[model samples]
Target: MPSETPYARLTPDLVLDAITACGLWPDGRLLALNSYENRVWQVGLEEARPVIAKFYRPGRWSDAAILEEHAFALELAAAELPVVAPMVFAERTLLHHDGFRYALSPRHGGRAPSLESADQLEWLGRLIARMHSVGARAAFAHRGNVDRDTLIAQPVRSVLASSLFPSSLHDRYRHVVGRIDRLVAARLEAVGPVRRLRLHGDCHPGNVLWTDAGPHFVDLDDARMGPAVQDLWMLAHDERAMEALLEGYASMRDFDHAELALIPALRAMRQVHYAGWIAARWHDPAFPAAFPFAAEPRWWEQHIIDLHEQADELE
Candidate 1:
């Protein structure tokens, strides 16, 4: 049973021990956070406020890639941005305990950001622009990119390899995914070359924590090199909201109106990638519990239909 998942050895005791290893005392309270790619928790402390302990998924990211993420966060924080940078221990941000790589951060609380308010959307856009300005200054030598391999090819491979994919529909799945791969690639090619920079990578509303002062970004774990639009598309819900966001963004950095053309292509890519992510992670106990529908044949059927529809939109 221990062989079932990579996180099998990450017990609560191990989590607390990891905190202790970093010279902090945990108060025996552990709350598992909402994360599927990696194991995260809110661990209490006896002498200080609660800290977030995130155990990295084995082999998902190399040590250098993880350090680059931490360095980016620290760089943003040093610029007086509200991003939560990881706490350093023994002069290192990335640390190890019992063969697991984990990091700690101070907990910040906030509710879902209200995108309905144009002012708020503009505010978020301004912050994103500022983040992008810093992101543009450097390149991530060890990180991945938001490209065909990550969003399309690799995910399609996962879905095709997944046991949960309906065996009867294997041929059909391949046809749809392959077509999507081609369409997405062609669309990206048509868009010409867009400026790629370090981005929050997954900047949906959830990653943002709002306070009385304003918003502070959390979870730079997905940070990587990509176009600036990758950070903006998720925060804006509609044309009006996007306009307001761009208004603020324009005040800070130049916007590639052409990058807007990539939105549909990017969306199609995400649709393909999301299914692959779920299928690839199905072995993780949390994924099954969180995505029970993925276990059913109907889900696969619907997924194929969705992919077909995505292709239509792309065309």
Candidate 2:
């Protein structure tokens, strides 16, 4: 059954027609990739290699913001960093068809990088350092900063406004996030004015693909301006792992150790932001299907407990 959501009009026929309009003939093979924020597909071509088509979620980002993301990926690729840059079509990267905006990229395949290996961690660090070197050369004009307002305050409001959050836990949720907000603010203040640069905002293991050649970064959808540690902290699991990454990072560029203190705060912000993200997307059928646990009362209770734990970590 076709979803009655905003994407109901995005049928497979529309997908094929959109690609055909882009000057590529579809082979009628489409595999829906693992994505919820936006619809992505592994589309086969008539006589050419398969390409990935990413359809942007409506009302999520303005055209200028999306273009900025493309430019950053291109900039990183131009600097010889292993990032998947959008495939240009007819002198442009962003394309429009059927009231939707999308981008095409050549399909590259690899498995998730092994984070347990010190060597791999160091290698990833160097890659990130190089990316930051390019990222620092310019600032985003359209994309907002990854600060308290976007990561904490706005998300809290979304949760409060949404019905997905259990009514019984409302006061507890508000109190927990309120304390976390203050803690995050104090932590940022203590860190002082740190150098902000373009970052792979959602740098997690899933975004990294490891092959014989090394790691290749995919998806600049979450790219934004923030502290360099925002890109590095998620990749590190512990002190030793962090040391390995920083060791390689220091070799390529200067790193401020002070950003280390911001990790726990950042982690807390992510927790709050994640729940908000789910709540914001509850209207989308894919969200409920994939995150059924979010609907359960026990899950909300556990979420509250997790927030308390994060608060303790912040102190």
Candidate 3:
């Protein structure tokens, strides 16, 4: 509970104790996984293979919301999709010990998916479509939706409040963010009312783990409600890439062509959100070490320029 490090109290001993509390015996081997919002680890076990233990960001999600995420992942797994749902130890998924909440999943190994290949993109598109097919079945009562407020406004507010934000470009940052807020809103309005289903919420390439068997969707921690296109846009970079994605997507479910226009808006929102996330987390010790550029005057100045250009594209 240190002011600077969110996971300061989550030492190796605490991580091990948390897992053992779940009735799993640890073998004293822990490999820290690449995660920021949550502390994840590959914990060795006594009688079984290693498991991925994810310690949630304290107070970020209500218990109900976290359960909603766990439920969604279980649903996808039940549907025979390649989602890594939390393991049910003693019929419970959410485990608690030493004042921290965490969940454990059987570890699955895979390298990052090669996004440059059409085969890879299409394969991912189909899996996502099938996942979305399940996502459309029901709505999450606790988890929020993907919208301008969550993606753009809240993050902008966080950035503006940051001491790390370059004072010289403060006004410029505000002006550019304001333009993006308005332009993104207008674009969504013009798209008309589209279906908002449960989404992977953060479906970028990084969240996906690919194997020869296909993609294993990891990290439903960002799970929420959104247009199906929200999940598809992040996987495709260019016009052709998006087309390839949709080609595979269409194989399983229908695509709302209107959602295609929502891409630029989503992209702008994500750009804004990333800056906001860094600013909001700057107080964490890990943030400074991982994103040293946040403290640089030039980075903030260039960020404003980049965001201004993104706002223009949204227009």
Candidate 4:
């Protein structure tokens, strides 16, 4: 594993070999591959059982992050949120190899919800609301200002400064960062203290799946102490779909001014995190094509335009 490669670390044979060594998975064949910050392979066993083996980007995350997810997934499941639970197998104590960390979970059978479906959007909202309710009932407060500053600094210092992207693209992202900074600044001025709780940090469409068990959420590697609204904002970023989600969430709980105020900044932050992550791992074999660079730049540009227009609304 190179220090700078954004790719996942496992090949099909390697993953199958690992599983077979455990003696639980037999005659399993790799069926599909998925990657973002980590690489995940969907494997089909001889018995028709499916499981997902995930190997994280070397040094991008830590063992503690995965442990936090397991703890919170249990909490959320106890509160009736639909989360995919991974079975514990051998050497599962946060195994480390080739400078990367890896973990395994059951393969969820359903696909990510399409934006074209209102029913899916509604289900997403309700699922988020239930997760929020679970967080509200938790004991601790949100962790403050940790990853936010790093995200803001990345484009100007890391991505742009690194020369990994073309000069034209670098300038475009710099402008996006400027716009994001302005929105975040204004939001901080207007929003009051927000209640914080444990969150599934990456709650976007990709992490959500419509399954036989109902709407199931996966990829809890970023789980940490943060605003539940962070999770909600990611799902509700698009206006029409967001409106449906808000309607569903509101059916269960009331929203206050501060939570609403944070949406614009959070949305931009979500994009920033995504762009940095995608750029980091573009060369990885398992990198998903859902938001290719060609499409993502346009999306971020539109976000900047929207942010400029909606700054006052958020304030």
How many angstroms is residue 205 displaced in model 1 relative to the true structure, after the best TM-score fit?
0.9
Models 1 onward score TM values of 0.97, 0.98, 0.97, 0.77
User: After TM-score superposition, what is the CA distance of residue 131 in candidate 3 from its true location, in Å?
Assistant: 0.6
Error of 4 at 303 (Å): 9.4
- Which portions of model 2 show Cα errors greater than 4 Å? 1-4
Candidate with better TM-score, 1 vs 2? 2
- Candidate 1 lDDT, tens digit per residue, 1-315? 242598998999999989988888899999999998999999999978999998999888999999999999999999888899999987899989898899999999888789999999999889899999999999999998998899988998898898988889999989998888888888889999999999999999999988998999999888888998999898888999999999999988899999988888788888888999998888888888999999899988998999899889889
Over 70-132, each residue of candidate 3 has an lDDT whose tens digit, in order, gives 999999999999999999988889988888899999999887888788988888889999999
Candidate 3 lDDT: 0.90
Scored by lDDT, model 1 comes in at 0.90
As for lDDT, the candidate ahead, 1 or 4, is 1
Off by over 4 Å in 3: none
* Candidate rank order under lDDT: 2, 1, 3, 4
Number of the candidate with higher lDDT, 2 or 3: 2
Identify the superior model by lDDT, candidate 1 or candidate 2.
2
Residue 119: error of model 1 in Å? 0.7
Model 2 per-residue lDDT tens digits across residues 168-258? 9999998999999999998889989899999999999999999998999999899999999999988888899999999999999999999
Candidate 2 deviation (Cα RMSD): 1.7
